[model samples]
Target chain A: MIPIVSDLAPLVCGLLLAVTGAGKLFGRRTAQLAANTVLVRVLNDGRRAGLALRAVGAAELAVAAALLAVPGTLLPGVATAVLGAGFTGYLGYARATAPESSCGCSAKAEGPIGVRSFARAGLVLLGGAAAATATDPWWTEAARRPGWSAAFAVAAALLLCAVSADLDHVWLLPLRRLRIRLFGNPLAGAADGPVPVAASVELLEQSVAWQAASPIVRSALLDHWDDEGWRVLRFAGVYEQAARGARPVNVLFALDLGASIDTTSSPAVRVSVIDDDTDEMVPVDLLAGMATRQVLPMAT
Target chain B: MSHRQNDPGRRGLDRRRFLTTAALGGATIVGASALGGLDADAAFAAPMPSLDPAISRSAFAEGRITQIKGSVLEVAGSHGDQHLIQLTNATSIWKLRTTTADQIQVGDGLYARGVDMPDGTIAADAVWVNIVNLYCTVKGIAKDRLHLAHGAQDHAVVGHIVADTTTASYLGGALTSDLSRVRIGQSAQILGAWRPADDAIDIARVTVGH
Candidate 1:
């Protein structure tokens, strides 16, 4: 029983390493990861980071091969333990010094080193230590007890997936989504309604008034105030009339909260141009005339 | 406030009437006309352009800085295009703070809005270095690092908290450097600098809670 459990440990560890190594060797994101990996950055130059990543991949594959292919050798087990320890140290270093660097443990994984990363490394180390006590290889043990081997393998793979942050979207996210759907989201009523500030901003951006004045608008939501039945949004603008000498102006849009404007509809928002210095409103007719003569013609 | 004197053939005259009336005292009357004017081209003669694409505006370029020669910068865009940005005395360079032209470095991401010269170079008016604003989920947290997941595809990103620059805003609270209250599994909005070579960021501000 002890020998079988010990033998299974190395098999699991070996499989995990093999998958990781494969990703580093031939993943589409390898170049991007290698270029940013703290381990590679600290040890190698810009051009050499790629070569270093490939070397690490090769080393991982070699360890995996020795653990799986070899019958009952303590050497493979010892090597695995050392490699796992090295990974742990590297992750710790990365977390401390280059906190923004990628772990580079998997092809699809671009996350920073976290607690799960440390746990995964520790698991590998423990597996390697268990393998050192085995008298037979996992394959031999599996042949003797096929049913137990299959169950154990399935359990081990599931555990590995649980520990891997990269694989979370496949299992964890679906489970979370299901739980949320069943129990309901805690943040569902955070804003109390569907019409958030972001939604209002989106509505404002989609308005015809925004389209007409976007070229001159210099700021994003400089000031927003709810007045009576309307939401007044302001932005800094430059009055481009040569007579005004490119003077600063305030562009205000009063959006009616009661009116539901569709995307296909013409905007039902009122636009006003206020003189910055005089604090006087520019005549809407004059600005509309200017927009028709200058802005709307440029649109076509 | 009346459009009685204006010709009905004139475009946007009804819109002006509604706006002028709305500004005065007749809010309900303005609302009725505004709703009716929804499909009227005469109300809004200018068409609203589609705003779905993430394309940068004209005279603006967003990319990674590949090379720098004096006041000139060679940028490689995310989309297979290259831009030559020329810095002038008038150009305002901003990283985490307002900085000078000499602070720009290779392997740094950049967003430059400027004038496109006849010779194809952009004479920059404003240059934002490595600026990235992301809404992300805090997947994991360490002593120094925060593992962030961003975008609809859940792209993993690493965010580093700088000592002086990094501040946190909790529940729409004041920005403070004391981030001991930050927890794991919360959604956060990060304003930071994107490291050019990798999928990492140096966070300037992190706003958590709704």
Candidate 2:
């Protein structure tokens, strides 16, 4: 069992390398994808990143071919080990410098570097180490024990898919989708719950009242409370006094809570300006010709 | 927030009607056509008024909240500046939904528009917290959530789908509340608000099929 598994390690690693290298070498989005990786920063040029990506891909393919064609040779295994070590170091640098950048190891993987990436790199290292000690080729082992070899290959393929974000849409997402369909979604009740505060803000921003008072109003919401059925939004503002300059004020907006973005109901909004010094309600009539006062000649 | 009224079409006329009707009244609470003329592109920040520019600058503050002191938030601006944001009962706090000031936490990013008080404190009017515009891929889908994969600092973001609030634009078509068109593995740009408590996002709009 141990000997056969050891022999199979090189074959499995070679297949992964072949797939990953092909994506880097032949994928139409290679250059675009490389730009999203740490390679662009490491190489110090966008164009150089693409070149580096292709070079790594070529190295992977060569190692893969060597592992497959000459598995018993110590030289191929040593070369695979060297490549694996380099990959591990590169992944570490990528994780540290650009924690959010994609591994770009597989070229197909766009997901950020995580535990799975380190594990994949480790697998390559281990596989290469095992391949170095392998006496019989993977083909010979498979021919000698066909059923065991086939089952092992399938299991290895599934494990590879589990770690590969590029293949998530194929199996993992479907499984998750199936689970969500069967057991019900985790986020189902949230939508049916209360309307978000943003909806109210959106409704307020659209109202004619908001348009009228916006010129006087300044600042984002300072605080708000539920007064009866209305949501009151407050902001900092200044009342323009023509040549007298602007007086610091607080803008208050009372919007009907029943209104929401989903509903077709027209948002009814009321505005008030308070004198910061006097604490008196500044009449809205002062700003009569504000943005909302325009009389459109073409109105129905 | 764009109000480019270049068209003389029906939509433009309706916008003008919405703007003109009850625009500036004594009561300042204009109803009727004020609410009636709103289309899909509801007046977000209608044509910028010819109001004083200095007043606009003094009334607005933007940056990350470095400290939360009671109802007052200490903000460190994007530039080299600091501000004290004062929140009161009249202030509307929007995280993803219209929420209270208590929903706001330290380190949350915000855009504040308010009165620049004599004491240098900004009496906030509207506060938007953690407003995020993310270009992501729908890695997985649930009944009420879209598992988004973004490239920025947050790689995997759980995007909550609000029933009535979350709208989808498919193949550059009309926006609809039907999220069924959002497929697994499709790339999308989601406009949302972040939840600091759970690190998830409440999606406002998801643009897909591009």
Candidate 3:
């Protein structure tokens, strides 16, 4: 089993290299994908970074072709090993220098250079080393032990797929969808929990009462309390009267406690302003006479 | 205190209805209000001898909540500053909605606007928690989510698309639910509830070509 596995290792390595090489050279949105890599940081130019990716792709393709055409050959195996080592070193550099950069190990823009990247590169290096020790080509070994060789190939393919983020849609998302279908989402409780305070603020902000009183309101909600069943929201505001330039005042907005974000019903909101020093209500006549400032986007 | 009935059927009812419809259609109400009005046309533009200094001296406290001992929050700012924010019944706490002080979890980012008290504490009137304004590159677009590479530091985030709630603003245009114009590699501004769970954002608005 060990002998057959070693003999077939080169073929697996060739398959991986071919896919990645082809992707790097001809992948959709290649420039955008390359920009996500450390190559852009290294080269300091978008076009140059793309060129560098293509160059690397060419090298991988050459090595892949050699491995495929001359299976079990020591030269191809050693070349594959060298390429793997270079990849590992480059990944380590990329990780340390630009921690946020995608591995760019494959043509796909995988999030960041993580453990999986190093492991995959290490696998290639080890596989190459093992392939170099094989006396027979992969086809010859498969012919001798057909079932074992087929199983080994399938296992290698599964292992590669496990570490490949680009192929996640092919298997991982499906498996995740199945899990969600069988057992409800873990975040359902939090999502279905009581309405958050932000929603109330959203609702209040949308109200015409808020729009009219907003000019005088200065700060975010300073305090809030329940009056009867109504939610009373308070704020620190400056009421600029005709005579008093900017009198520091308290603004209160009252709305139903059960008010939610719904287009069907427009809940009544009451807004009031009180003078801080005089402890008197700011004249509603003044509030009523204030001009409405236009919302810019709405004008467009 | 004073208030007038918000009669939608008053004179200029069409304009009022237009404003209401426009506000409802846009998902960026939180963000737009958060930005605040510049060059505000004061309700009464006039001169006064005694311009109250308290109105001009609004204390602002922004940072992560290091400690939450009941209503008073101990916050550590990014600039090594510490602040004590006091929440009251009138003080509104908003985290994805208007909520109570109990919803404010420790380690959550906070911005408090209030009056400064003599005890070196702020009497917070409004508090917004875990609100994020992120500039991102659209890496992948799914039916239910957007894979984004956010900020210069390159944090990968998942932006969830809530039906009827999430909106898109295109080229400085009006906000709409039609997100067909959103494509991969577009630069966008995401204003939403950035939660710690799964590093995801319940996106309220995505503004592209801004």
Best by lDDT: 2
lDDT of each: 0.65, 0.71, 0.69
- Where model 1 places Cα greater than 4 Å from the true spot, the runs are A25-32, A107-109, A143-148, A185-194, A197-218, A240-247, A260-264, A287-300, B1-210
* Candidate 3 per-residue lDDT over residues B1-210, each given as its tens digit: 221112233214463343333223222212122222211111112333323344456667889999988678999999999999987644656665445667889889887767899999998767778777778987666668887887643557899977655666666334555666775667998877678655589787788987
What tens-digit string does per-residue lDDT give for candidate 1 at A220-260? Answer: 34434455667655555556664655655566777664333
Residue A128's lDDT within candidate 2 is 84
What lDDT is reached at residue B128 by model 3?
78
Instruction: Please give, for residues B1-210, the per-residue lDDT of candidate 1 as tens digits.
Output: 112212343214453344344333311112111111111111122434424121133367878889999788999999989999987543556665445667789988888766688899987656778888888987665556677888643667899876545666667333455565555568898878777666579887778875
Off by over 4 Å in 3: A27-31, A43-46, A190-193, A277-279, A290-300, B1-155, B158-210
For model 1, the TM-score of its B chain against the native B chain is 0.63
Off by over 4 Å in 2: A26-50, A241-245, A261-264, A286-300, B1-130, B141-146, B151-155, B158-210
lDDT of 3: 0.69
User: Which structure among the candidates has the greatest TM-score?
Assistant: 2
Clashing pairs in model 1, backbone N/Cα/C closer than 3 A:
none
